[model samples]
Target: MSTPVRSSPLALTVLALLHYRPLHPYGVQRLIKEWGKEQVVNVGQRASLYRTIDRLSAAGLIAVRQTERGSQYPERTVYELTAAGRDTARAWVREMLAVPKREFPEFPAALSNLLLLPREEMVEVLGERAEALDRELAGLDASLRAEGERGLPRVTMLEAEYLRAVTAAEAAWVRSVVDDLRTGRLTWTEEALRAFGDAGT
Candidate 1:
C-alpha cells in the first residue's frame, strides 16, 4: 500500500487552469492575472510556476506539447492536463471543499500585539484593517456576482463564488475581532504576552 502524494497549492492551481484548456506558461500567467485582475498574481514568479508544472508533469498529471514558433524563442511548451491530471484536479477540489479551514495567523498575531499598543492607537489600527478587509470583500463580492450574472461557464463561476465566500467569511471574522476590540471583550494578560514574545524568539 503506497501513501498518496499531496499536491502543492500552486500545482493544483496550475492543474486547474490547464484543465480548462491547454496553454503556454505565458497564457497561464495571463489567465491567472485576468481572473484576479483586482489582485494580480506576480507572474514574475515564473520560475516557481514552471517548477510546479515540472513536478506535475513528473507525476503524470500534466503533459507538455511543444510548438516551434519560427525563430525568436525556440519551441514553446504548452501544458495540458492528462486524464490523470483531470482526476487529480477533481480530487483536489473535493478535498479542499471537505476540509475545515484553519484560522490564518496574521490576524491573531496582530490582535495579540494590540495589548502592547495604546488603546486608541490599537483601535485605529484594527479599524483600518477591518476597513481594508471590507473593501476587498466588497470588490470580490461584486466581481463574483457580476460574473454570475454574465452566465460564465460553470467552473469559472464556481471558482469566483468560492473566492467570494472565503473573502466574505474572512471579512466577517475581521468584523467580529474589531467588535471585540471595540467592546473590550478581548484582552491579553501579561504572562500570555511574555509567552507570545518568547515563542516568537
Candidate 2:
C-alpha cells in the first residue's frame, strides 16, 4: 500500500498566511494571532507555530534570511517563502476545498479519554468550543461583509467570502453538536462505541 501523506495543519496555515506576502517567524505569529482573535489557541502555545515555520524552511518551501540580533541577548531568524511555496499554498487551499468534511479526530478522542470526568464536564467542554466557533464565525462574517462593501479585487473578495462561508458552516456544525449533547440526543455509550468500531472497520 502506498504510504499516507503526512502533513501538519500548522504548516498549511503558515503557507496560506505567507501567500499574501513574505513574513518572518514573528510576523507569522502576529498574523496567526490576528486571524485567530477571539478564538482558541491564544493560550501561549506558539511553539507549534514556530516549529511549523522551521519545518517549512527545511522543506525548501520557505527560506531563512540572515539572522538578526535583537537589543536583548537573543536573535531571530527571518523567513520568506519561495515561488514553489506560494504555489504549494494555493494548491493546498484548492485541495482543501475539494475535500468533504467529516468528524474530526479531537472530539472523539476527548470523549474517549474522559472516562473519569462526568458527562456534564464533556458537555461543558463542547459548549465552550461551540461558543468559541460562534465568535469566530461572527468575526469572519463581519470581515467578509466589510471587504465585500469595499469593492476590492474580485479574487481577494472571493477568498474572503469563501473563508467566511467555511467558518459559518463550522460554527453551525458545532452548535448542532453541542445542542445534541446538551439535549440528550447523543451519548457516548457502549452502543456508540460499537457503532464507531463498525464504521472504522
Candidate 3:
C-alpha cells in the first residue's frame, strides 16, 4: 500500500507518546494534558482521539499491545507504535521543524486590507495590537521563567521561546509603522491618494 498520511497533530502526538511506552487511550489523554502537549495537539474530544487511534491502526503504524479490564471501568485497548510508525514520527517532526507552511492568520489578513482605513485609524489599531502583543510576551516570559525554575530544559520549551521572539519582532515592526504614520514619514500625497481612488473606480 501507498504510504499513509501521518499529518494529523493527534496522530503524531500518539506516535510520540507510544514511543515512550504503550498506553491506553485514557492514559494518552492524561499524559498529553499533563505535559501540555494538548496546546499544540488537538485532542479536544475523546471520540476524535479514538478515531485517530483507529486510523493509525488501520494504516499499520500502531498496533494493540494489550487490553485492560478494571472492575470500576470498561476495557481499554492499549497501543504501541510499529517500527514504521516510529520512523514516520521522526520524519514528520523533522519536516515540520524545517519547513514553514503558509498559514493564513488573521493579522496578515487584516494587514492586507489596512488601506481601507485612514492612516491615523490604522495607526491606532496597530498600536492596540502592539500593546496586546506586549502583554502576551510578558506572560510568555513569566511562563518560561517558571519552567526554567522547575528544571525544564530550554530545548523542551523551544516552541514558547520561538513564540516570544516572533511576538517581540512583530510588536517592534508595528511600533515602527505607527511611528512613521504619526511623523508623516509614510504619509500619502493628495495626488497619489486621488490616483489610487480613481484606480479603484
Best by lDDT: 3
The reply for model 3, stretches above 4 Å from the true place, is 1-3, 44-48, 71-74, 189-201
Predicted structure 3, TM vs. truth:
0.80
The residue-by-residue lDDT of candidate 2 on 78-197, one tens digit each, is 777778777777777677679865757676677667656676886787678878868876877777676567775657556556666766777688678668767889766878877987
Which regions of candidate 2 deviate over 4 angstroms? 1-5, 35-44, 101-201
What are the Cα lDDT values of the candidates? 0.74, 0.68, 0.87
**Cα-based lDDT at residue 38, candidate 1:** 23
- RMSD to true structure for each model, in Å: 4.7, 6.8, 3.0
Tens digits of lDDT, candidate 3, 40-94: 7788899999989888888888999899999998998999999989998998889
Candidate 1 — which pairs collide?
none
Q: How far off is residue 106 in model 2, in Å?
A: 5.1
Residue 25's lDDT within candidate 1 is: 80
Alpha carbon deviation, residue 133, candidate 1 (Å): 1.4
Clashes of each: 0, 0, 0
